[model samples]
Target: MSTSYDITQDKWERFTFSREGRVLTAAITSDHPVNGVDEQMHTELALVFNCLQRDSESDIIILTAKGRAFCAGGDFDWFEEQINHPERFRAIGWDAKQIVTTLLNMEKPILCRMNGAAAGLGATIALLCDIIIADETAKIGDPHVKVGLVAGDGGALIWPQLIGFAKAKELLMTGDLLTAKEAERIGLINYAVPAAELDAKVAELVAKLQANPKWAVRWTKTTANIPLRALAAQLMDASIGWESVSNYLGDRREAVAAFKEKRAPKLTGE
Candidate 1:
C-alpha cells in the first residue's frame, strides 16, 4: 500500500504520516509563540491536501499542532501585505476557501485533534472536521469579530447548524472562548478528554473507522456532508464577501486597533 503522507518540510512547517495506516500528520513550527496560517502556511496546506489526495492508500487525516495554541489565525504581516495588495487579498481569500472545501470533500475521514487553544480559522477548521476531539483544557472560539471581521469561513455556516442560530450568534458576536467541556456540552466538539488521553482517544476512534468497510464509511461521510457542502456552496461566498468588506470598514478598523491596544473595542455607528 502507498504511504499515507510523504514527509516534507517547508520554511515553518512539517508534514508526515503516522505509523497507523492511512493517517496523515502535520506539524507546524514557527518562531512566534503561536502558529498562524500565513501565506506560506496556506501554500503548504494546499500542497499537503494535494499530496494526501494523490496517495490513494490514504484513508484518514488528523491535523494537530505542536505548541500551546493550535493556531492564532492570520499573520498580521500577511494581513498587512493583503491590505496593501487588494487583488492579492481576494486571491488569497479564494485560495483559503479552497483549502477548507478540499478537506470537506476528502474521500477519507478527517479528524481534528484540537490539542490546544483554537481560534479564528483554526476553530473553523476544527469544526469542519468529521470528528473533533479536544484536549479537556483547550479553549475554542472565533475571534474574528474581535478583530473586526465577520466570522466567515466555516464559522458562520457550521456554528449555527451545529449549535443553533441563537447561541451561534452570541458566541460569534462576542468572541467568547468556550472551554472544551463547555464546547462538548454545546455540541461544538465531539469529546473533551484529558490532555494526555487526547491522542489515544483519537487513535481508538481511528481504529474503529479503519476496521469498518472503507467504501461504506466513505459513502456515509460523503452523504452526510452533502448538506454541509450545499450550505457552503450556497452561503460561503456571501459570508466571505461580508467578512472581506468588513475589513475595510471603520468598525473593523477600530476593532483591530483595540485588539492591538489590548482594550475593549468600542463600536460606533458608521
Candidate 2:
C-alpha cells in the first residue's frame, strides 16, 4: 500500500497546492493588486517549501502564480510599515534566511512556471528553482537596489552562480529588468517560450524528469545544489542583515515616498 501525502492538509493562506500524480504544483495565490509579497506571504513562503519537501508523494514541484505576474516584488503598503518600524523588518530576517536555505536544501526537483513579471524577491524565488520555463512576455529581475534595499534574499547568492559574477553585478547593481528571452540567452533561465506555449513546455519538461530514474534525478539535483547551499549558508545572514539595515536608511524612505507620490527618488545614498 502506498503512503498518501495529502497536500490539501497543508494549510497555507497565501499558497495553494495541487498534485497530479507525483508532480505537485505550488502556486502563489496572493490577492494583492500585483500579487506582491506581504507579511503573511513572506512567512508562508518560508514555511511552504519545507512542507513541499516533506511530501513524499511529490517527486517534482512546479512553482508558479495564479495571476498575471508571478510576484510583483514587495507590497508598497508593507514596505511602508517596514520603513516606519525597524523591529518589524528585523523580525522577518529569520523568515528571509529560511526561504533561501529551505529551498536550497530541498532534494526534489523544482521547476518555475514564470507566467509573468517576477521582480525582487519574486525573481529570487523563481531563479532558485532547478529549471525555469518562462513565458516570452514575462519579465524577471531583482530590483532591490531600486528601492534602496539589498537583494540579499537569495538573489545575490543565485544570480552570480547562474549567469556569472560580471553580468550579475551589473543587473543587481542597476536593478534593471530583463525580458524572458534575454534571461534565457544569458543562461539566467532555462527556456523562454511563447505565452500560449508556456504550459505545454512546462508539461514536456515535467514528463522528461518523470521518465528518468527517481533517485538518480533527485540525487543529481542535490549534488548540483551542494555549492549553492554552501554559498547560501555563508551569505544569507549577512545579506539579510544589510537589507534590514537598509530599511532604516534615508534612501529607502525616499524611495518609498517617491513611489507613492509618483515622482523620482532623490536618493541621498545615506
Candidate 3:
C-alpha cells in the first residue's frame, strides 16, 4: 500500500473522508437535516467505494453519518423535482445500480455504523454492508412503497436475500420501520447495541475484521456475496427502471404531496 495515494483531491461535497491506520471512515456530512440522497450525493454514493478500494492505506471502511440521522431516503424536494424532470431519474437509476455493484465488487469489508434512524436507501446501504451494527435506539426499513415508489434502488434486490422473500415483501409493502432490536431479531441486520456502547461494538468488530488475514477476509466476503451479486445483476436494471417509471404516474405525486402536507395520501390507483 502506497502512502502517496490520495482521496483528498476527490472533493466530495456531501461527505467527509478520513483514514486512521487501515480504517477509513466516510461520514455523510450533508446539511440537509436528515441527510437525504440528492443527485450529487447519490452519484458520490455510487463512486466513493471504488476510490477507497484504490486507497492503498486503507483496509476496511466505516460508513456513517455526521448528522443525528443517517440518510432518510431521497430528498422530498428532489422527489418533487422529478415530477417535472422525470427523465433525470434514469441517470439516478443507473447510479443506483452502480452503487450496489461496486460495493459488491470491493475486496475490503465495509462495516455500517448505523448511529441513528435509517430508512429507504439508507436502510439498503446499511443492510448491504459486510457487517451491520446499529444503536438500539435506531430503526430500519424500506418504506418506498409508502411514498408510492418501488423499492428499485437496491432495496428490491437486497432485502429479500438478507431476510427472506416473504418477510421482505411484507415489510416493503407495509412500509413498516423496525426498531434495531426487532430488525436484528428478524435477521435483517447483524447487531444492535445501546447507543452508549455503539462505538465500542463497532471498534470491536473492526478489530476482528482487521486482525484476520486480510486476503482471507476479503475473499470470504466476496465469495459469500456471490448469490447476492447474481441477483443484483439479474434484477437491478429492470427494478430501477420500473421505479423511475412510477415517478411519472399520478400516485407518486400524490404521495410526495401528502408527506409535505402532513396528511394521508388518497391513492386512486391511477
Candidate 4:
C-alpha cells in the first residue's frame, strides 16, 4: 500500500477531488445546471478511476456531484456537436467504453452517492458502482433510447444483471426514470434514504468498510467483479461501436430538438 498518487493535484476542470483520511471523494463539479456530462466531464471521469485505483490513501471512493442532479444526462449542446460533427463521436464512443471499463476494473470499492436525478450515461455510471446509496429524491434512468441512441455504453450489460432481463428491457426500451425507492425495490440500486440522511448513511458504510481488513475487502470486490469485467470486455467494443453508428445514422437530431422544444419527435429511423 505504498502507492503515492495525489488526485487532488490533477487539473480537474470537471470535478473536485479530495481525500479524508482513507476515503477519497470525487465530486462532479460541472457548470451545467444539472451537472451534465459534457466532453470535459466525460474525459475526466474516464481517467479518474485509474488515479483512484493507484492511490494507496483511499480505501473507499465516494462518487457524487455538486448539483441538484447526480447528472441529468449528457450536455445537450455537446450531443448536438456529436450530431453535427459525426467525426467527433468516435472519440466520445471510445471515452464511453473507457469510463465503464476503468471503473469496473478498479480494485478499490466505489460507492455512488446518488444525491439527485441520474439519467442516460449518468444512470449507467451510478448503477455500475460497487454500491449505490441514493437520496429518496433522486431518480435514475437510461434514456438513451428516448434520445434516439441505444443504451450501449454500460446500461445494456449492467441493468439486466442488476434487475432481470424482462424488467431491464422494459425500462431500457421506454427510457423511463424510477424514483429512488422504486429503484431500490427493483434491485437496481443498493439503498435509498431521505436527503438529509444521505451523508450519514454513506459515512456509516465508509467507516464499516474502513474498519475491516483492507486487502480482504478489496479482494472480495475483485472476486465479485470478475463476471462483470468479463461481460464488459466482450460487449463494450461492439456496443460502443453501434452507439456511434446510431449517432451517425439515427434520428438523434430530431429527438434532441424535440426534447429541447418540448414537442414530439418525428423519428423515421433514418
- Residue-wise lDDT of candidate 2 within 54-136, one digit each (tens)? 88778899999998999989999999999998899999999999999899889999999999999999999999899999999
Q: Which ten residues in a row have the lowest lDDT in candidate 4?
A: 1-10
Order of the predicted models by lDDT, top scorer first:
2, 4, 3, 1
- Show the lowest summed lDDT stretch of 10 residues, model 2: 2-11
Clashing pairs in 1: none
lDDT scores for all predictions? Answer: 0.77, 0.92, 0.88, 0.90
Candidate 2: where is the Cα deviation over 4 Å? 1-4
lDDT of 3 at 176: 95
> Estimated TM-score per prediction?
0.89, 0.97, 0.97, 0.97
Report the lDDT tens digits of candidate 3 across residue range 175-204. Answer: 999999999998999999998998899999
The deviation in Å at residue 27 for candidate 1 is 3.1
Candidate 4: lDDT of 137?
81
Off by over 4 Å in 3: 1-4
Better of 1 and 2 by TM-score: 2
Tens-place lDDT per residue, model 1, 106-213, is 767888888888888888878888899999998999988877778877788889989999999999999999999999998999999999899899999999998999
Clash count, candidate 4: 0
User: Which ranges of candidate 4 are over 4 A from the true structure?
Assistant: none
Q: What local lDDT score does residue 81 receive in model 3, on the 0 to 100 scale? A: 90
In candidate 2, which residue pairs get closer than 3 Å at backbone N, Cα or C atoms, i.e. clash? none
Residue 260 in model 4: shift from native, Å? Answer: 1.5
